[model samples]
Target: MPRPGARDPQAPVATADVSTAAESMPRGQRSAARPIPALTLVSHPTAARIGERLLLQGLLAGREVALSRNAPDFTRPGEPLGLPLGDPFLSRKPVLFVPVGEGVRVVPGDEGRCTCAGEPLHGGREFGPEELARGVPLEFSGRTVLLLHLAPPPEAHAPASLGMVGQSAALHGLRRHIERVADVDVPVLIRGETGAGKELVAQALHARSRRGGPFISVNLGAIPKELAAAELFGSVRGAFTGAQRDREGFFRAAQGGTLFLDEVGEASPEVQVMLLRVLETGEMYPVGASRPVATDVRLVAATDADLEAQIADGRFRAPLLHRLAGYELRIPPLRERREDIGPLFLHFARQELEALGEAHLLTPSDPYAPPWVPAALAVRLLLYPWPGNIRQLRNVAKQLVIGSRGQSFLELDARLAQELRLPQTAPHRTPPPGAPTPAPAPEPEAAARRKSTEVGEEELLAALRAHDWDVKKAAHHLGIARSSIYDLIERSPSIRLAGDLSVEELTLCFHACGGNLDEMVRRLEVSKRALNRRVKELGLVPKDA
Candidate 1:
């Protein structure tokens, strides 16, 4: 019997025959079932040592048997035995043993057609007798049995490239947003802090897009001012000095695919105007060319800088910003989504360690344990401004994994702390105790107490409102854990539940923000995750009422 998961040999052969076979066989014979060839079990030294067993059934009674070192030559029996010989015969199966030889072969008939296919007595193929005598070992299985090799099934190939790794809510939301926009031909503007993996997101969008052309990525800030326009829109020969030949720019190169413009806020006004015209009409005029060339391309622009702020400051064009930002996605900085740092650190460390071929030296525990960044490091990471975001974190992890000879948390933390110029400890300043202590008056004492209470109440109310009166959002917005937020809400008297909000107020805020969560989050200065959780917890249905 064939092994489990093994493909049936007849299936492929039958498919090929059905597709390619000609009409030569008689109709009755073609439809009639042929007797399956007898299966002879062959054992090798390895198989025998492992005690592998094979069971066979359905045999004709009184069939004559002959055994040989190579192929078995069978002859018809002169007399039938009591062991029945009909098609429906049932009886104890007889066990027959043939002499052990270099290999086993079964000859089914006198016509030289062997069950072994005349190929070999074992797993290997047999050549002519002369070649077999020359000690080629008969190209058979010999004393060692081996399994047959089979082809793999066809499948749609997934890209083998690496992508940003992290399943934190922030990253999941970003992935969902990318999926929603990838197939559309609309322009996408990605805004994030530097090192926040904006380029990776752009690449993912390109990979998911239907367009099959080249994905051209251009860093607008990297291009020289004189060559910016020509580089983006292409240039004709003799367009400028030393112009040897006509060159197709990124826009033309990326036809039908995606054109990624990184640091787009850095584009000069002249380039912006040119880009605006190209976006307005799907045509571009090459430098020194009289006519405009029409080209199809999807635009994906990324900027660490705030383009809206740039426009307000007149550093960027407002109209161009609108054209570029057809669909805007903002990637949160690492500091904002500190929950993802642990996974990202491990991902980069493993990648770098593998690249250096020192993967064995670095274990999975290396990134999570002390001497590098301990569990306490999460708090520090949360506090960090992370001006460089995920990119900086990846670089730091790579550096630590490469530089640290001993995978200890303390050593790693010391190195990181020193590099980041963290304070060793809080500084202490002693004041003169002899100096007269300022005594608070009754009115001033009362005012100070009232101010303290007001600050606490304001923060509590702000968190409560941001979370839609759900305790969770209030906690996240305050940067404390969920339990802390719940405790504060339980203690606070001024805060109201989301369900208690007047229908009119809910409708007003929802309409004012156009049902945009990010806008709402920003308006409330609350964490998006917390706000969403609060929305669900509070059972507040969004007002289209």
Candidate 2:
């Protein structure tokens, strides 16, 4: 978003909430624009396309709404939206979508294959208006995924491709803004949080513009103060210490194209004057050049900082701000568009998996097993307050793909949990005086034990190494059951059990590591528990405990 990337002339882009895009409509149009219950396809058994909506306004006339395997009344998206899901694994019985007073009740069929929020749906579950507003994910037969959310009625014109993904209304609004101003030949001031994908919006503007020049992007905050002027404008040879020849700076490089300046608020006072001159007169003076050079480049600047505060502090020039903000595009934070999380995740996962020739990971195994990306994880992704925005979500997608390599299913390790900032300890709150006594809480867990869910592959390996391959000690230290730890080892393709090692190999490694079980664990990569037992059975002299 430059706040969700769209044009709204009525309000300042900085303060506009993209979620309330429909609120701006006239009284008559507002009723037509009011969001109604809808289901958008996220994934299909055989197709990767998404974002086709199944509006319920026309389909549900205050009665029951049905989503069966053979439902043929609805419109199709990328896949046969009016499917049989084309998934042979799906049950013949249909899942009912009954509209209650304000919320919709999802009644799972007898097969019990549906899941949401990381739990299997065995019975009817009602999604409140609030939950549906944020969007609820429903998985069928471990293959098809549909997001149940509130969406406005269909528009006469579909959104043009601006390289943005998702079916959220905010995204639609953003497209509207970009389409309106892309070819107006005006400097665009993009305001958004860091990692909110401001540069993507800038690119979209350029892509949609009439200019045929290349897009040049640079981070104003990253450029050194001394080099800022020379970098933006050209420098003649012998003008500076590093200048051996005439330099074509960003302005000239992007001639007739768009130049995106990220973190524009960080521009120094000196550079500010230069920018002001360029905007005022369409001419710039290079650091060591004698004459002014005219540039036809479109200017797009982005910043997450409060420029008004900087203006009050006398750091940034107000005149420069006026020039850069010919048009404003505000990008909404990731938290505002939770419905897009699932589709965005799949988009990223597919890219990474396909690149590594592990595209098969995109599909679940046999019907009984879970999907590669767990529903709980998807819900967590939606719930997480991503301060880093879309950039953070992309990182998580890459982590899941690389971390789950060679495994049948992805595991939630400690590192990922910490990164997502998922709650670890239950913080005790002081009860008010004279309040009724609360029920006793469960026993406190071990002080420093590492549970299976809390330990990542590397962390688990390190714990084993620290405990010298003693499974019991490691299990105790990890606060996990020994059997569960063994299961973790069994699932790890990189780790080996003592049984897999030959007696000769064990004896040779025993001498190689000088019978140091810890060292042996590192070299053999076998379970310390099994290795220790083998050492005992071999009757080797017990050196250290």
Candidate 3:
């Protein structure tokens, strides 16, 4: 029988890597199973209705491959397989597949929407689990959608950096661009905010490239203006004052491989002129050297600065920017892709635990460290704007893991606020003038079962307010599980949440705080995490970030 919620056993879920799944199957069953398809064009009417009549499926085995519907052209060929779907409506190249883990993943090309078993697949989402289990011969969009599980492709392990760890469209687009240009010899420009992992993207490009030479990175901004040329283009013996021995620069060091020039925007005028000449002629002249050396390097340049503005100001050369930006990749900041925070934190935390030789501390049932588990941590993580991006988050996770002293809730809220540079203040409230106030606080554990059972929306709201709108605290007061409290929040949409500020008012305050999250938290008089959530709910993007 197929797995639970599965439609058929003939085509099991594609979530698991092909190797593991194939090895698990019985020898006889494995041989009987159909081969995985490089391109499966389903022609069901329901699929047609969903604008996905042509479903081009393929394997992601580390190497990049393309799935196309049109006939293959010698001038512009598709990788792995090229099957004609007989549907002219579909684009020639609808999607590209990049292997992740032991499984395959598909990235939609310019094609609008892709569906599996009638359910739409968002960007970076794989076609497996429910859709794969639905099997072949399923009817959709007024035609029969076909499933072909051809023999699995060879397994190739992907590097950890390739695991960009997000399902956001921005990340998917970045991966797609990298796959398209990785194998080719070209100049690429990577632009993003500082600490946004620009070097990681450069490394990913080099890792995926066919060229197997050493990867060298040069930080142009760090080099003194006078030494720029010598640092990048080398200097021969007796070329300058010290009469030092001949030294190979970044260009020669990265021969036959990839050369990443970080902060290329910092290139001096003389350096820019030389760089332009070398990029155009495929050679560079060493400082004080009579002859030009033949350079064989795939150049990938990155900058957090606005090169266009620099060009306009005559600080950066237009031609050089044009040359370096043969293909451009933009990496969105952490605040922009908050969905990735939880996974990234867990990944970093595990790495720290393993490094500290405390792997056993993470039980299979609770891999996340105590006090600051995934569920609670996710709320805090998603709330902050993550000004320092991934680098900042990694530091935070390391601190949390090392500091969790076997407490129930890991009493680090104050530490986190301080570390985040947020202002520290206790929550407070005062009764209205002349208002008759007061009743003794109820002993939560001693509260009668009847009173707990009689809890209603008003009681829940009061508890939440008493605890400063903490979900867990409110749940305990109501004698219910935290998950049940979450369910209540979801089911009762009309219930007034604790916060009284409107979206516009919160946005105005955020702007007034000059997009500083710490300042905004203090100004709003809320917990750092709570403020983060409200900002997200209002779809606020810190102007500075």
Please give the ranking of all candidate structures by lDDT, highest first, separated by commas.
2, 3, 1
lDDT of 2 by residue, 191-299 (tens): 8767889999999999988357899999998999888888988789989897999989999999878899999988989999999888867788888887988878789
- Model 3 is weakest, by summed lDDT over 10 consecutive residues, at 44-53
After aligning candidate 1 to the native by TM-score, how far in Å is the CA of 523 from where it should be? 7.1
Error of 2 at 245 (Å): 3.7
Question: Which scores higher on TM-score, 1 or 2?
Answer: 2
In the range 246-312, model 1's lDDT, one tens digit per residue, is 9998888888788999999889887999888877777789888999988778788988664644564
Off by over 4 Å in 3: 1-161, 364-371, 374-376, 405-415, 421-545
- Rate residue 391 of model 1 by lDDT: 72
Candidate 3, after superposition: displacement of residue 488 in Å?
A: 47
Q: Regarding lDDT, does 1 or 3 come out ahead? A: 3
TM-score of candidate 1 against the unseen true structure: 0.49
Q: What is the lDDT of candidate 2?
A: 0.71
Judged by whole-model lDDT over C-alpha atoms, candidate 3 comes out at: 0.56
- Each model's lDDT comes to 0.50, 0.71, 0.56
Please tell me which predicted candidate would have the highest lDDT against the true structure.
2
TM-score against native, each model: 0.49, 0.67, 0.48
